[model samples]
Target chain A: MNEIPQIELTGITRVYGKGEIAVRALDGIDLTVAAGEFIAIMGPSGSGKSTAMNVIGCLDSPTSGHYRFNGVEVGRLSQDQRALLRRHYLGFVFQGYNLLPRASALHNVELPLIYKGLGRAERHNAAHEALRKVGLDNRAHHDPSELSGGQQQRVAIARALVGSPQVMLADEPTGNLDTKRSIEIMEVLQDLNRSDGLTIVMVTHEEDMAEYAQRRIWMVDGRIERDERTRKAA
Target chain B: MLWETFRLAIQAIFRNAMRSFLTVLGIVIGVAAVISMVTVGQGSTQQVTADVEKLGTNVVMVLPGQDTMQGGPGGTADPMFTLRINDAVEDQIASVALSAPISQSRARVIFGNENRRTDIVGTDNRYFEAARWDLNRGRFFELSELQSGKAVCVIGETVRESLFGFADPVGETVRIKTLSCEVVGLLKSKGASTFGSDQDDFVILPIKTFHRRIAGNTDVSTLFVSVRDGASIERTMEEITALMRDLRRIGRGEEDDFEVVDMEQFATMLSGITDILTGLLSAVAAVSLLVGGIGIMNIMLVSVTERTREIGIRLAIGAQARQVLLQFLVEAIVLSLIGGLIGIALGLALAVLGANWLSIPFTPDPGIIMLAFGFSALVGVVFGFFPARRAARLDPIEALRHE
Candidate 1:
């Protein structure tokens, strides 16, 4: 495709501390992802895969580099401007399923829309549609504690999709799930990517989970060691 | 957005209801103490003012002692000096409307078979005029009767009830100590004074009759001097002080042996003392408010720490730092406002109960209630700022990584 990539990074570096004890989490690197692509990033514990995801999600700034989200340089933007960008275009899912424990599944799905300043009726309708897309419409009233691990992950996916973001960044989406639950989450994410043409960047160590993506990028020691295509682009 | 923040805050506060209530308990106690103390103090001051008004503000009491508060010259002066002071005030001072020498003692009075111990006052007819007392029936003492030192007396309502039991005692003969005195008049009823002493429990007789028969000595304890209406009490007091000093042979640079106590000044002094006490107590109570604010700050800090992950989640979900700060701040304000409302109710309740117990008027000041409410809100803002800012300034990555 000749269209401009949705995300572009050039020479990104992230250092954690000061001179002597400083740890460089991500060394100089460059990568780009086009619209509607499903990509998975994989590495061992200290390989800086999570830091790369954080930079892509606008949750952390690079030490010295350019991060272009939709071709707009994100590194130069203020903290509030970046937050607005995140609100309007990006969604994230964490390993812990980070849904507010006290809130119901529907409310968790409605969280992003609330930050988007949507009206109550619009938020409810959109949240319901997102939940139905994740095959969790019947479990909308249940709290996170009441839902199974796979169900909770589905609710989080619904929350990410409710904002109608251009990209979804999921860190260890199936890290806490059993084999069956992991497959269930991976199938829901695959179906979303193929049917809705949603772009996703997932960080995971599981090879089976990475197979759900069309392309896989492997990180090692703060740099990308390999990038390979497992399937043709949808 | 603000409404959403408020709703979130309320939900968080309700999540740990017991802890929230305990956090605001200090504010409740502090506000309650301040409000109740001031309310009761105001009520007492009002009562004192009303009592002094009843005694007639123009009346000045001349006692046979120096200013008692200063621990100055103690004990009564010479008995003849009191009479001389009264006579000098009556004859020399043009501002003096009426001056009467009064000698008092407690004595038992008997009528038929009923006898009771009551106060006996010895004075002339000018005493009734100076005291603004009225005769309910019969008449006051004639000039000849006072001059001849006749054993004629006027009975107060309390004595009349004790001795005659609602019977007309105007012409009844009652024995006072060892002398048999005829009741020439009946005094009207005057209720309890400021000190809760019964004002209608005394019998009045001529000073001469009291000096010759009951006391066996011409000793006048005090002089009641009433200033003329529209005359300056300060000027009249200065003149009386000058005349009394001249008559008592007290020289310059020496304190007078007698004290001229203006009823108005006494009332003012009483109210001033209560006001000072109330202010001191309120200051102490306000310290507790400061402590309450600190308590709120401590709890807010703890809450921020405990909710670190939640803040991270909110931040990651595109919530602005200002929005997170606003959430915590609203929670603190709502908590303290709840405490303030409870304190107001408790304080007003205590004030009413205290007023009834102390027999003072219940006076709840609306201005104080408003001040307390506004102060609590201010406390919430001031103390909640640090914790809220800390929460806002948190690094989302580090916060999310927190266990």
Candidate 2:
């Protein structure tokens, strides 16, 4: 299908430190993702897969790059502007499920909406809806510590989806889960992609987890070693 | 957004309730110390003023020697420098409504077995008028007694209680030194004087009797002059000085042997001393407020470091850097504000208790209260900024990765 790309990156190079101690975290990477696509990035430790996720999530800016999101150059935006971009256009789920330890599941899910300056009633309703989407509406009052690993990840996914963002960025969504819980999480991602037409970019080290996405990208050292479309799950 | 941030800040503070309370303890003590110190100081100043004012603003004292002479002339005391303010000089000052020539000597007065060594003042009927002393029992000595130099005396309330055991001493005879004097009157209790000496601890006798007996000298050591109502005290003092200078035959530029002191000026000087003392005490107490600010800063810095992960999550969820800064800053301010409020209550209670125990007036100064509260709030802002800035500038990725 002919469509404008949702995200485009060219010559993305991110280096840490300087001179003899400098390490290149990202090396001249070029990538493109269309709307409604689910992609997985796989790499070894220190292979820059997380760095790529950060840059794609707008949590970090590349040292030098021409990165575009919906035809707007994201690298040139101010820090606050980038924050606004993340606020309205992107959602992020970390491997650690970084929900506030003291906040309840509902409050955690409503965090992005709170940043968006939504009304209290609107935020409550939207958070309730998001919790229902993850099938955890009954546990909306439970704290993160009270929830299982799979339930916490679902809560994180609900937080990411609460904003109805243009793209979902998940960094090792199933990193801390068992095989059954991981499968459940993968099924939720597959359902969102297939039915809701939501775009997702995920980072994982497991080959089986990577198989869940429609496209798998393998990275070596800071560069993309291979990118190819894979068969959809049965 | 501010409300949400405020709620988050409160939650964060309450999460470590003990730490937050301990952090604010410094502010509590600082505010309480400053408030109580100033309050009690003001109360003492008021007490002094009230006591001095009770001595009568229109009254002035004409003591022997120059005004600088303390303790009735120093070692090798010269009789020439010691003023002989006799009855003749009192009659010469026309600006005074009345004047009393007074002499004093230390003597033991014995009635029965109860005897106390106390000051024995020698004056006339005019002494009661000039000193504004009212009689509580019996009658003042008659002009006839003063002129005939009778051995009758008036006992003060303290002497009456000490020598008579609450019984009237008017008709009783008390032995003063070597002479037996009849107590013709009882003076009212004047409580304590401004300088903290007991005003009701002495007995008064006719000056003629004192000159013939106890002191054995005709020298009047003091002159109590009462200016007429609507009469200018400064002008009267000048007139008294000129008359004394003329009577003493001291030419111009030759220092007079006597001094005239207006009670008003003395009262001002005493109050001024209290003000200076209060200022010094308040300054010393203010230092604790600064120490309190440092305590808040230390706790805030710890909170910022400990909550680094939470800050990162907030930033990642699209919180502006300034919003995060405001959150922590407001938290610190709330802590100090609450502490300041509690301290004010405690300080006022303490001040009232202290004033009661010390028998001084409890003076609550609103200006100091507002100033103390404002200073505590400022302390929070001043000390909380750096930690908030550090939290705001933290890199989201690194913060989220913080263990």
Candidate 3:
């Protein structure tokens, strides 16, 4: 499909602190992603992969950049406007599987829908569907503490997908899981991408985990050192 | 949205029920103290007002000295300074409705085998009208009996109860000292006064009979003067003062030897004093409320810190800063409101118990309860703000990295 890119970043430069003590997290980066591509960013510590994800998720603004989302200039938007963008178009799954510890799996999934202002019954159904997609519908009533690490990450993914965002930004979604649980999570993400054609941008240092993505970008010292398409879609 | 936020807040508060309760304990004690103190204070003030009303606001007592509230005569015990029955005989004053001379002495009365020490008052029937006392049964002393200085008396309900029990005391003769006095009437029951003294515990005798038989002299220690309903009490008091000064032949600049005490003014002063006491105590209790607010602030700060990761999760999931603020603010308010409700219940219970113990009426002021509730909610808002703001302003990236 020939459509406007889902994300575009031009001359993105993110600098922390100021003057003599300045540190640039992302130095003059330019990139674009189509509507249905799955991309992975791999880097070591201080390589700025997380910072790039933050910028893409609209959780943090870049120091100097032009960021466009679905052809709209996002860099000039206010903080609240960015939040609304995140609420409507971006879903985040952190490495810690940040489901509310006290909330049931169903309620945790319902969190994004609550911000989306969905009605109770409608949110409930959507959350159940999302949980079913992640193959954790049976664990909906269980709290995060009662669930396994894989189960908790699935719940977090269900929460992200409940809003049906335009893009999912998962920062090391399987970082805390064992290799077996990590492969299981990768399979879920791969199945969603294959069947639903969902756009995704994931960050991971594990090479095998990054191999699940259709395209891979390796970063070093705030610059992209390698970019390659490993394989075609299934 | 608001309902959902409240639900979330309630859930979070219930998650740590013990901590929430302990955090609100200060508010509970402060509110309870303020409510009970004000309630008990109001009850006593009302009792005092009722007691003074029974004395008849239109009535003014002319005592033979100054500062009689402390006790008897403040100056010299000169015979010339004492009130006489003749002083009450003057009907020349325009504001005077009724005037009766009263002289009282504590004496033991005996009827059959029963004998109890009680106050013996010497006054005519006009004292009943001036002092608002009504007879429960039998007749007052007739004019002929009063003129002849007959040894007749009217017994109070307490005296009748003590001396005659269930039998009628009228037509019976009660011995006071060596004098046998006929009981002509019985005063009605007035229950307990504001000071917890029995009002129906004195015996009344005709002043002439009292002077000739029991007192053995003509001396009236106090005078009860009732002013006309339409007359100003202050003006009447001034007139009485001038009359007494003229009667005593006092110089213009000299203070009158006698004090004219307005029953209404005394009642007002008593109530004023109680009001100040209630306010002072409530202010002290309010200090505790401030301390309670500080307690809430401290706890909320800790909660915010403890929930940093949770807040990060919420923000990452696209929760607005305002939404997070509202959640924490609602949690604090719910905690405070719970404390307020419990405090109200505890305070009312204490007020009821205090009233029963002190023998005063129990009066629950609804306005004060509403004020307490509103104040607690206000405390929640004021104290909950900073911590809530701190939570809202947190950077999601940094917060997520927090342990």
Candidate 4:
């Protein structure tokens, strides 16, 4: 099979500050992501998971690394290039839900497509399709503040999915939800991975939450501690 | 894309409408004050020129005893001494149109029911044309009356007004010192001089009458000479110089004891001083625009700080660094442009009001209006740079993290 990994990171290291005060946020990390793999990163706080997410999301630069995304070299890309990557190839859902409080859920979902230069009607259709996938089509016109926590998260997920990105990175996608809502969100993520063939990378501290992914990677002190794969249910 | 950015800029301004208006008020008032002050200064100059032209076009004024004047380089004050001779000036001058001997004194006058103060001028009929005057009610004194030293006088309009109000003082007798003279004619109106001196508060009589009845002497204080029509003033001035030297009985190398003035050159000389005043006023007013520019800079800086999050959102949503910079810069430019437009309106309105107050014509220069507006836009660009650069250089990640 000649299909290469959709994303790859090799010997990646990030340094901050200078001399004695300097610290490494990521150390000698290597990883590969298949086109449709659903992977979870489990780590304690400040284990560089969020920092790695920033690098993977193209919002930041890694101090030292050879990072490849979708078979293209990404480490040397310019700011504009990374913005293009974020626009065309990657989607993001952060723990804060990050939906603008004043914007309606429909506007929030259409925002990514708007930046992609889609027409208004096309953007509306895509946003509605994504919102329907997340089971929040009825909440599309509600502001983030007017919606419940689970609904807001679904709107955020819809925003991520609206662009039809190759990868969706969810950082603690269910961190702010109760047990029932958390399962519902995980079910949505699982359905996307199973039915849509979208590569999913989730960051979580909960073992039960990470167990839902096909593969798990553990991190500590800015370094990878373990890698494990869960067996398919018989 | 530019249209979208423009819409966003306008929207941002309207989002805090009152704050934006208050911020631009400094620029508005500053520009308006600048326009009004300059227009007022120019209006006064134009009014003065019109009034001076009424005296006589291309006329030159000469004065006697230059050594008797005391002031700074450009200071204007009354000369301390008077010319003592007029005989030489009467004969030697060439291309002469009219020449009149004049002497003056401050006098107290008494009429039928009024007492007033006036300048007592002793001159001939030639003084009328030289000074651009016409009789208001009767003919000028007859040549027989002029040569015979008759005790007759012509009063200026202001003198008539002060002594008679709406009544006709002509054909009536008034007393100056001990002489009782009939007002044979009244002079037409001549408004105030640039220095606010009353050009109409004067009495005109033949030089012969003034010398015999008032001064008890043959000496004349000054000579008012009018050159031939279309004659080069310099030629007549040279002739007057030779005439004065001969009439005063001075030797070839000795300076005559009198002076002659060309009214045209005198008007230019006076205008030169006012031009300097106008230039200085404009310079001081220009500083207000500069201060207005600084006000824009301060407000833009505050705006950049206030809109940090919005900038981050824009950048994240695909705005280039230059795009962010352009957005802020255009916001400032739009603000200053609006200010300039409003300032022009307010300034022109004030200029019209000022014209009425000063009793002059209302005129607004289109060039000055364009200049004021252009200056405001230039201020926006020059002063808004730092704030725009600050916004463009902000880290999007840090901005996203910022509240």
Candidate 5:
């Protein structure tokens, strides 16, 4: 028996609205990703790159497709089942570094573990370890707004990593950062990919950000325009 | 999981303190109004019962006519209706410890320069026993005075004060309209009756004297009957009704022209009316609770909208939609519970003050307190559902892009 891929999408289509106003956000897309692979999705605006990321994240469902995650049919799962899958298997990081404004860095990072039903002490320790990985452990008690842009994004990354998810999905993780902070975020991703054997899926339009990934998939007009292995895994 | 949700909800509420307080204000007023109104009403009912009980327990009044008029000692006599339970009917009921047939008429009493118009009650020596009247000075009318129909009277506290000032009026004579009656006794003060009439205002005289000189007729309108202790009042009242019907020659099926008014029945009737009034008032006040709940819902909706991005972050971090819903719902409940607590305290304070002002007993009803609190919580659940569902149903993708 052959080992199953981490994620497989066959003939996935996602349509928005209805009638004449209908828009095909993801049109008949097929893709497969192996375990421990670091991939980047790159596209221009209105090319369905973000929509594809949402579909792959299980935050949006495909209109017609087979979505399998680790040998299980995810497309057939209920909303709560998808949530449970996300709880144990996936981590998400957004361009906005979407940490709760009123919550401290530690609390923001503890969110995923809290949903995992981990005890308070266990959640705190795991969140602290993740923050240490992102080099934001010292700023754990500060509110997200009180931290700089780079530090806030680091807290979000810590939140994603705290639950030890099988895959980390980052939607333009450094989109709001300057060159200096973008490099800092890219280095952290590079370190995780190299040292932890963590699977990672990132979406970005920047060529420099895409270069950090070992593989690149380019989307155009709701379909994959190009797929290539750009570099060998570290 | 619920505990964490509750903690998060509380934290979120405290994040915007001013907004939270304003949101709960309506609930506070509503709960306070319901609690205070119910409390004061219960107090009034208790007051009415106590006042009636003070009139003399286990006392039944047999009036000459049906319940056509309202007053303790005054009832109109009809010329055509001829059911009068005479003094002989008093002796027929075995449960009767004391009974007195009373007849009343208005009279202007004058002694020296002081004069006042007052109610003149005519009854036998049993009036003191049945009506629970006490004497402070002088003697009650002797058997000779009652039989001879002599012009002798016992003045109540108010009557004695009006006609004789602080001076003793036991040996003096006071003119009653046309007849001059000797003041043979002074009755003790019983203060005011429940109906606001001064119990110490009426003057008492021998029944025969009142009939021969003042009324010019031998008729009694009310028979005050006090039952013996430990006797069944219902059975006694039934016995009295049967005897009265037989004496009046009324058939078994015919409605007796006279009605027996029991003090217990009167108390129950008065309290029933109070309970209805309290319920109505509390219900009206509960309308404000609805408004308060709506306020909570409105604010919760606004909060969910305002925190769309936060919600998106929570969703992406693997929070179930139901968890989000539970969080907001618990927030609403916490707000109402706090409001209920404060309202209970405020209501109790208001009730105490109202009791003093209204001259009723301060009776705190635990049942009403619990009811008000439980109703407030229900308001939370009922009004909290829509907003929470809206929050839970938000798409994480759209919420992430809300800003």
Candidate 6:
């Protein structure tokens, strides 16, 4: 890749609790993603792929070692700075379809804009633009309860993209969906990644879903077992 | 952001609808109870006090004892301690404007053929003005009748109505205690007083006649002294005590056997009971509010527990901890505010209704409503705090992991 890495994790480690009760979640992880790279992580149940993703997304801190997002060292950032980083650079999608159930799809998507302290009209216009890009503009006024599982996920994606972040971190995006719906979501994510050249790092276990990404990383017992790049563009 | 939280809070209450209504029901009832009880109690006490003051600023009926007598001490078993000195201290003492003596005795009044049992009040010319008695007929009896013990009297509206009906009772003769007396004057009607005593009852006569003919005594049973400018009641009382002690020839250590009372003194005595009632009612009302606060806390804790998953979802989707806290806190405050508003209306209504029942004008102090609403909102903040903080402090990972 000609561009410098957008996200880099070097010798990162995360452990929970202390001493006898302590459990390691991510052990000595070394990874790098160039600009516009799409990477997927896959593992068994005991693996800490989700923990690793949280660290990369700046949602959690690494116990040891450093994480750099867009060339800024995330490990050294303050809590407010981390929040600022999340606002300015990183977008997140969790497996639970984390749309606020009481909020309209437009409001849910506009949440990050609220944190950014954007004006009402600007945020509304931006949220509608993002929802339109997801092909669910008509459903923007509907609450999450009114939408199906797949459509809710689409609204979530719109929320993630609303702030126009440098990278999108999704943890098991299709984990709650059926096989047919899973492929449809994967197709949407793939189109966004290719068309906008948006860098995305996703965690999943389904082999077919992993095939949509250009690179894959496998984890075993909180450690990276393998890293492979399989589908480089010609 | 606060506005956003407010909107979501309203939405959250609507989510379960029934649960939210049930949760805030305690607060509503408690607020209404406090507002109504205090308002009505305050109104009644105020009405009673005003009525008492309206009786007369000049009248202080000493019923031959230390403890005050109901109505008048009409030949009661208590030892007589009547006026023994030149007790007309107002013209004598600088503090006093005027002084008068009254002795009450019950007797049947006979006018023509009709007869009615009534009280005979024996006093001087000053008694008419001091007791707020206005002449409705010719005039009060001449001052010579007071000194000569003449059989002259002034009748009240009730006595006039019962004995003479529409006839001019003035310039007519009536038999009291088997002694014939000329009615030289009639009194204008004053309404029933706070003690529920009939102010328009009985007859007034010269003190000399009351002593020699009706009551058969030269001593006065009660002395009422009106002060000029209506200030320094204590000074006037002190001088009266000193005057009584000196005139009675009692030793230095002996206590004076008289009481001088005014509106302020009466107000002081009555304020004790009213204050106690006011405090107790307010405390009971406050307890109800406290119970309401506890109810809010209980419901909010449950809400926090119920919305754990939802909280996790929001946290993952870029919602900050403050947003979560503000939402729940706003929900509680809104509930309380609505309850407070309803309570203010109910309280005012109860006060007016109570006033109407008692036949008194109702005036609600706006201060009470402000204080009540302020207290409720404060309760919401204090009680809703822990739950809101708990929601804010929740770990996203752990919350999402909950079943």
Q: By TM-score, who's the top model here?
A: 3
lDDT of each: 0.89, 0.86, 0.88, 0.79, 0.86, 0.79
Number of the predicted model whose DockQ against the real structure is largest: 3
Off by over 4 Å in 3: A231-234, B67-75, B80-90, B108-117, B135-186, B191-196, B208-214, B246-255
lDDT score for candidate 6 against the true structure = 0.79
Candidate numbers, best DockQ first, in rank order = 3, 1, 2, 5, 6, 4
Q: For candidate 5, give the lDDT of residue A180.
A: 94
**iRMSD for every model:** 0.8, 0.9, 0.9, 2.5, 0.9, 2.5
Residue A89 in model 4: lDDT: 81
Per-prediction DockQ: 0.63, 0.61, 0.67, 0.25, 0.57, 0.29
lDDT of 2 by residue, A1-234 (tens): 667799999999899999999999999899999999999999899889999999988889999988999878997777777788888988888889999897899999999999899989999999999889889999999999999999999999999899999899999999999999999999998888888889999999998888899899888889999998877553
Tell me the TM-score of each prediction against the true structure: 0.85, 0.86, 0.90, 0.76, 0.77, 0.78
Greater TM-score among 3 and 4 belongs to 3
lDDT of 6 by residue, B106-201 (tens): 999998899999988888887777666788887887868877989999988989999998999888999997689999988998755545567788
**Per-residue accuracy of model 3 over A1-234 as CA lDDT, tens digit each:** 767899999999899999999999999878899888899999998999999999999999989989999988898777678778889998888899977887899999999888888889999999999999999999999999999999999998888888889899999999999999999999888887778888999999998888889999898888888889866432
Instruction: Give the lDDT of residue B116 in candidate 1.
Output: 88
- Write candidate 5's Cα lDDT for A1-234 as tens digits: 999999899999999999999999899899999988899999999889898888889988889999999978888777777788888999998898988888899999998888899899999999999999999999999998899999999998998899998889999999999989998998899888778988899999988888889999999999999999875343
lDDT by residue for model 1 (B141-206), tens: 999999999999998898888889979998889998889999999988876665667889998999
Q: List model 4 lDDT by residue over B1-403, tens digit each.
A: 4654576578667877887787778778877887887787677777777776776654554565655455457765434223344434444455776666677777888897788888988887778887789878977888998889899999999888888889988898889899899899998887767666778999888777887887777655566766777888888787777765665467967765556666666666777776787678667767877887788899899988877876665555555677789889888888888888888889888889987777666768888889989988998899888899999888867776677
Off by over 4 Å in 6: A76-79, A229-234, B13-61, B67-95, B103-125, B133-221, B230-258, B280-291, B326-377
DockQ metric, candidate 5? 0.57
State residue A207's C-alpha deviation in candidate 3, in Å. 2.8
- Candidate 5 local lDDT, B1-403, one digit each (tens): 7778889988988889889989988998999998899899988887777777676778998886644454246665432222145455567777888778788989899999999999998888988877777899999999999999999999899998887889999999999978899998998887655455677888888998998899888778787888999999999999988988788788978877788889988888888998899989888998998899899999988988998888887887788899888888898888888888888899999999988777677888899899878987887888888888898888888989998
Fraction of true contacts retained by every candidate, in order, equals 0.54, 0.54, 0.62, 0.15, 0.69, 0.25
Clashes of 2: 0
TM-score of 1: 0.85
Alpha-carbon shift of residue A120 in model 2 (angstroms): 3.7
